[model samples]
Target: MSRQRPRVLARAPGQPQALPASLHPVLRRVYAARGLAPEQLALDAARLQAPTALKQIDTASALLADAIVAQTPIVISGDYDADGATGVAVAVCGLRALGAGAVHYVVPDRFRMGYGLSPALAELAARSGAQLLITVDAGISSLEGVAHAQRLGLKVIVTDHHLPGSVLPSAEAIVNPNQPGCGFASKHLAGVGVMFYLLLATRAQLRAQNWFATRSEPNLAELLDLVAIGTVADVVRLDHNNRILVAQGLARIRAGRARPGVQALLQVAGRSAERLSATDLGFVLGPRINAAGRLEDIRSGIDCLLAADLQSALPMAQELERYNRERRAIETDMRETAELMIEDSDAAGICLFDESWHEGVVGLVASRIKERLHRPTFAFARAQEAGVLKGSGRSIAGLHLRDALAAIDAQAPGLILRYGGHAMAAGLSLAEARYEQFAQSFAALCAQWLDEDALQLQVHTDGELRGEEFSLDTARALEQGGPWGQGFPEPLFEGRFEVQSLRVLKELHVKYRLRSADGQSIEAMHFNGIEQLRERGSLHATYRLAINRWQGSESLELQLLDVLD
Candidate 1:
């Protein structure tokens, strides 16, 4: 964690518009560090609202309408992750609300179906007698899969956010913002967001034609809770449109009107939906949604999102909580094992493989090890029956994981076998015997692609804060600004504090009630910092800040990130 902290970025890119003319020092520091200018914080309802004309959405609108008119049998294909599962639920519900009762959905099992739309999935749909296949959160690169679906007499409409390949799929309609030949601003839209907008457009077209005479349109905005969950869970950028969606969903959640599934899930995780924050979504909710893909089928994930009754959702939520627990245990065990492997192996890059490691948890182990070791790391688990190993890799910034694989794909003839993903995260399969070759080639490519600065990790703080500014109102404003996920990060402010006192929290963490050098007091805490402080045998430190909650009340807490003497 020794990366250079940029000296307070004067203009963090893409700051919100129309900020106050004279901001508080803390606000200026926080906003400026996050790439904001005073003019950028223009919090106008008009500026923040989503745009209507998203190009060719009208075509998607017309296509779905025709499908409804002809009563075409349709199936929604989704990934096993939260974004994909919620996307499937959204498409089905939104479509059914518009009178498409012939709709069904399909999700791929991670072990068998793998990721994305493929020939096997097409074959599955063909056998199901589905005529129109709409893939959500996937299918952008299914060039072969699209062709296979067409041959099987299926019309495919893909709403995905994956980076498209050079040869675009031959689908009847493709609605990915990142795909070529199509222009949709906010390239950072998540898969669920794309699906959500497509549904909105479909509804608009139906209303224009007076499709609903007696029946009123279901509150489509009600689905924003799911949309917001998926958007944040998928780790996509929260642009203007997405921020509004997230903000609206958060407001509803705080007001106790989020969906039954979300509400039930909060109860299972011992979190109150009324107190939902982006921190909860990223750390708690996202992991639960991902647990199904990590440990088992994502049916529980989809069920948790689509459950109609709060009571009906409870058992699924309980099971998901169980999965998340098991997931954490397995990830911890595997990461420890992988770290030992790295400590021994003198390799250019890290690639640890084991037949005993749970396959579902390897990606997470890879990510954890990457954070610990600060190198591009890939954790591999053998599919013993296939005589091959599947690996999920994570990398530091500056190195594109997918492009690195593409480079290896070009240089080495048949080494990688199969692969695809984005810059920071990726997946692939290769022969077990070729681990050395693959490891060497990938390491060489990473070193060539990555600079020294990319390997170091640094925390970016919004600004420093004083105890006086830490209040219920300030925290509330920050909380409202929250539900902050990727792109729009939760504000993190650092401040110097004299350690007035400290306690060993279960011997696993440190608890503190601090006072500034000027006699200002602030409640503070440092999770997992007991050992570090004990090693030094002192608590004279300064730390970063976050709000600590208790008994329906909020106060500023200095979360001791690193102990600086």
Candidate 2:
């Protein structure tokens, strides 16, 4: 696959004067460009939107309170990913603290059962003798599963963050912000965020009934550590509500008040809890937890979070680390194969399949291809069932992936067996025999939907850093200014530099000693960028300011994002 040179543009300037005079000039400009007001920069937990704003939250909370009062057996059905794993941990811990007697969880096997709540999963939950079923991160699209659970004499409540289908499931209570008629202001909550909100509402209900008068009330704030991990791992937009949640969680972790599981995972990842950032959560810990669901069972990841002590959790974290290493190897091989397959065609959208590809790793492969080509790409692998192909898709801007899949499904009924996801990412399954048809249909849809401007890759930067601003203090200030992700992006700057020296590391990464046009020498690293550098002379680059800590000292470094002539 040929690399497309992206168009570089500066972000539109913002009303920096509107911000506090104490803020750094760069940060003021950065915040202003994102349209964040001075008050919006405050990420106190108290600033979070009230749970009462969520439609049906009261009903869901009352139902949960009743189950706790009756000492009913409950099962939490969670999706198989980082968000789902953390959400399960939050639910189990929060409910047990709230005086629930019996709460068990069920996660689908990606290889066997596939994603989400299904009739098969419901049967398994019913067999556990659960009278009440609560779904975390899933069940919005599980109409059949909800009906099946109800038929088995179980009351169902769904707490998902995914977009709902045309018809809502007939669960006892649905608490998705994106559902029709829901007035929740933050529609971008992750699965874990929704579960955390539900817990808050349930705690309030229990308090209203004086259930906590005789017993100790649980500090729901203690669960924010897991909430932060899941929210960032799931890659949800960091709206004001989410930023508050993550900020609180980070404070707890920094204060050494996080759960044993989180501490143990951080230990394994070699990240310091005191200086952890949202980037660490997304890139360092998220992948390790998600590796379990992708390759083996998500229960391992959940068990780590549920562990009572670091000694008990370390082994599980190590297991997750092993799974992550395996996942990386599988992803690399699959990506190479996909690149070879798409070397010939220049379709607006891309679809690739290999019988040898692991079903669990297709999503990562799709994400890699989509990032490289800036196209909506799907990668498929043969499912456990013969003649079935399971696929995962990642989309560029201007394409709603789930909506695109829905359009294809509506235009040709029976083409897709199952599908659900968000705007940028989604999963689906179809017959292996229909691969060609689905490919052509997907390509046609993307071609029809995307225009030249949409297809062209673009990188927006926050202008350039002044010579005096290129310091460790500046990097630290920028780092402190964000719990950034998705909609709230981290600050990126563009500049021209003369390459003083360059060296290739392991034949993949390029390490450069560069002299900025302002005559300051700086260190920069371009990971997996050996191919992008043809002329080592003067070059334009977009990068993020970073603090590189080694041994005991920290220095300013630039993490290159893109390079241009």
Candidate 2 error regions (>4 Å): none
lDDT of 1 by residue, 327-421 (tens): 99988888777767776553335677878898888888888877666777898998634888999998876888898889899999899888998
Scored by lDDT, model 2 comes in at: 0.92
Q: What is the TM-score of each candidate against the true structure?
A: 0.92, 0.98
TM-score of 2: 0.98
385-415: candidate 2 lDDT, tens digit per residue: 9999999999998999999999999999999
- Leading candidate by lDDT: 2
Deviation of model 1 at 325, angstroms: 1.3
